[model samples]
Target: MATLMLQGTGSDVGKSVLVAGLCRALSNRGLRVMPFKPQNMSNNAAVTSDGGEIGRAQALQAIAARVELHSDMNPVLLKPQADRQSQLIVHGKVRGILGSSNFREARRNLLPQVMESYYRLSKQCDIVMVEGAGSPAEINLREGDIANMGFARVANVPVVLVGDIDRGGVIAAIAGTKMVIDSADSAMIHGFIINKFRGDPALFEDGYQSIEQISGWRGYGIVPWLSDAVRLPSEDAVILEKPVSSAKKRQIIACPILPRIANFDDLDPLKLEPEVELVMVPPGTPIPAEAALIILPGSKATIADMSAIRDQGWDIDMLSHHRRGGAIWGICGGYQMLGRTISDPHGIEGPIRDIAGLGLLDIATELAPLKELKAVRGTAFDEVLEGYEMHVGITSGADCKRPFALLQRQRPEGAISADGLVIGTYCHGFLGSTALRRAMLQRLRINSDGRDYVASVDAALDNIASELERYVDIDGLLRIAAGAGQ
Candidate 1:
């Protein structure tokens, strides 16, 4: 099978999006294609069809390729907790927790596992598109690096380096990478692609040529900034720092940005609504009282994020908002924080202890060692909604009797307060369902335009694929994938 890996000059260089767009584009060309990432470090995760979890970006790429979600797509996922430690997931199962120092050593040992997944995928597909994490230029990290060049070298995969021109220094980022890396590693990269270019492409014609001349790598193409990307779920928390909606929107939906926010892209659909304004309230910024709904998103560390909210006075703000009859909705860890008490005897997150929750709901939760990962279908507000559950807590109390939704598993999930103003669920992506979105807007007395969010995402993927056809050198990329390129 032909294999091509896309590595970025640095993080957030549009490598993931490019890989996704290319996957869809190649699939459109009637080629059996698959996306692979040997290792990924992100809290934004998605439940796979295999009843396991993988990085959300890989999940999105699978959708783009029109394939089933598989944990083998991302064999090694590192979800950062705190204290320089991360929860390591190996082949869709939790292996254990490892600190920074130990993780470096552990990663080398996991190479065989990574290769096994890669080989399995390669055998099933005509072309396997691999995505590299961070930059391969970090010589320090190159020793035990299963993420980029190391994986490329082992798999004998051709690499195409990508640099974000919008970030500036596109020339140095590409050429510097060539200068810093070892000769063998440098030889793996056949060509380079400049991403996120704005304005006239002619302006950068000289610059692109300079990169080609300096690095002796062929110029693939330059991709312009895609506005349609907003419709797709972003996999990084760095995107949460900026405002997601315009201030002029009539209805305001505020979400407090926790320190270790996970799966914050659940708010992406809300940003698409014209009348709805979505705001991410950072630390020290109080939740707006005028907000019609305050959504508490999932967190990698519930206790620590809860403490951060208290320290920022956001807990008081949420209480005040609740008193004003504003709606409060929590997902996963946020749901745990909304309960009366949260106990972690095994210290799954941190030190063994119990902490008081917001007490908005009568329920209590105990963090467990076993995590639940499932793709679920359910009904909320009498509207059909589908989402996935990925958490490690068991909640129970009198309030659970008023479940927020009836799941497909013939059981009630989540809880609703007696006042009907508080709702908490462990499911993520519930709002992406059109029926649920409309019902939620109606509850807030806002007009619904009846948009199909799933269709919008599909259309966005098609648009990205179309753009890739126009901007990227598909023929050259295909040749590179076939191991026939310089």
Candidate 2:
């Protein structure tokens, strides 16, 4: 089996996107390719075919490779609950919360588990493309690092470093990484790829040669800016800081950018609608008054994010929107916040206490230790919608009598107010279904475009693969993966 790992000079340097594109390109060549990440820290997660959860990026890469989703793709996932603490997931199951200090020691001990997953995946695929988390240049973090160089060293995987030229300092970032790291780690990186280049690539020919001269690493070709990336689901919440769309004269769909928002990609389908303008209301900004729909997205910490909404005065603004006959929808943790009461007596998320909810739905929820992870199909407004459930609360009350959808054609899921203005559900990715999206738009008295969201995503993957094949050295990369060049 052949293996190649992609490590970046820093975070958000297009490493994940490059891996997805490469996976697609390689799979298109009739190669059995698989993507792996020893460790990942992100709240955006996706349910796998094995009835478990992994980082959302791995799930997207699996789709690109045309393979089944598996928890082994991402063995160690850390979902940040606070600045210093996170919930650790091992082998697709919650292992409990760990503070910053303890997590380091725990990570060192988890190396065997990570290797086990990597070996199992390598045995089944012709090529395994591994993605490194953050940078391998952080010497302080290199001691117990299972994310980057540490994993590369033990797994005997050749590494190709990537730097974002659009951010500038591409030469220093690449050469500087070589200067700081140990000789063994530095030797693992055989070549470098410059990503997100907007202007002429020839203009940077001198700068690219400078990096090759300084680091003694070959140039792996520069990748131009990918415009179709916006169609793919972003794995990081940092992307929410920027504007989603610049279009005007369209219906507005406003969503509050919670501090710990998870699965905010749930709004991606809505953003693609030509008739809708998706606005992510940042902190301290009130939800737009003219927004036809106010959506509360899923959160990693429901209680804390709920408190943050009140602190930002979004609660009052949402009430005003509701009074004006605007539609409101909440998913997952947001659904918990829309209920009458949210109780966590066991302190699953923090301090043990019960807090009042938005009171829009006459239901009550109690946070539990066990998380619900399942793939579901249902019908809402006479349209079929399929999604997954990843939550930790159980809800019940009078409003449930008017359920928002019939899940699995028998069980009722979610709750709707008697007035039919507010809807809440634990299901994520409901809008990905074309029929459901059209029905939702019709409910708001808007004409539906009836676009197939799944087809759009597939087309975006194909576009990216074509871009990679055009610029990247595919045969050279394959040789590097086979250890022929090294």
Candidate 3:
């Protein structure tokens, strides 16, 4: 089938990024490669070229592979809406909301769809690099698991376990995981890869030998950490809050830390500015008043997180800043929170609750039954804004009064108050475009040097992939794909 699996020791061990690099590596070798994830759980998603929504990581991988994204690449997506409830997207469409416990039991019913998607990708690509979610040794969830060992075992695909040495316990994490996996699933593991290695590769000689001796899995390679990875657009919402320093003017920008953060790459383009620093302030941290601008980023649980905003004291800070004539901008879920009131009639976020918003803009929002998921092209802040639409609320009345951006057919989408201090939009990538980013920052009295955000990110991926290709044995991976010993 020309398919291989990339399994990780645990979550956020760099499996997704490695898969992206390998996909680019293989594609650079003149082979058509595609990225696949049997199952994924994240609220941050991407709209495909075909107008379907899939995990954001898979979308980035597809971009790295230089292939068109499709829903078949990620057939099962679980976007958590609450602690125990999630909105399930099967084969690219919403099926409904299910509690986490019920979702686990219902996952088995999607196995057929999983296999079908796998086989379809197999037929179309020269090689399909599959990403396994979390750890394969999660024995408790392994019974109903379709992401790691379960998918690998069903497809009989060889696996390369990626362990992050930077996280510490590299030896224990890799060996312990191997020791606990079922015999059949263990047999599918072709080799082990030590990723994010900081010191000399030779320094890990003993550690490499020990992993082989203990797990009986060959050591494929030891990849050093890529420092310039800032060029690659991040899809993991967890890492979106890292510090971003801009070199253009040496000023910092902060985004209001939302609890249920999603699709946070909206700030990535700003990172390209050499003089700007993008700071994602989570709850408890004080928002600096000297910052050039404050953005209220997207979120999954708007009402719940809005409550978090008030609890974290940001609501008070925002109010204090607004009176001082500071600029406040919000996108998507953040846009909903800028209104006067938000009502959850369908109880999508909570039990049909209604809450007061920041009141920056004179508007009201109501959570709706239908979700909006599609790629959108519009003009915002005097620039062409290209991004996907994903939300479950409708803003109405005087709140939706001013139009911030013109969508297809020149329809106004969001609003800008008469004072111009507060602006809100449903668009996510408004800041990615140079014209839009410049316009918005100019309105805040901030000067910026333009940057080619997308090109710089793609170039970073290319450099990282080229470096990894030089160290890893490509022929060895092909042999494993052919069901042979490396």
Pairs that collide in candidate 2 are none
Candidate 1 lDDT over residue span 1-486, tens digit each: 788999999999988889899998999999888899999999999998888789989999999999999999999999998979999999998999989779789999999999999989988998999999999988889999999999998888999999999989999999999999999999899999999999888889999899999999999999999878878898988887755538668888899999889999888888778888888888778899899999999999999988988999999999999998889999999999999999999999989989999999999999999999998897998999899999999999988999988998768999999998999999899989987888988988977677777788889989999998998899989888897222
Q: Please, what are the lDDT tens digits per residue for candidate 3 over residues 16-39?
A: 888888888888889899899999
Q: What lDDT, from 0 to 1, does candidate 1 have?
A: 0.91
Ranking by TM-score: 2, 1, 3
Ranking by lDDT: 2, 1, 3
RMSD of 3: 2.1
RMSD for all candidates, in order, please.
Answer: 1.3, 1.3, 2.1
lDDT (Cα atoms) of all candidates against the true structure: 0.91, 0.91, 0.83
Q: For model 3, where is the 10-residue window of minimal lDDT?
A: 240-249
Weakest 10 consecutive residues of candidate 1 by summed lDDT: 240-249
- lDDT: worst 10-residue window of model 2: 241-250
After aligning candidate 3 to the native by TM-score, how far in Å is the CA of 162 from where it should be?
A: 0.4
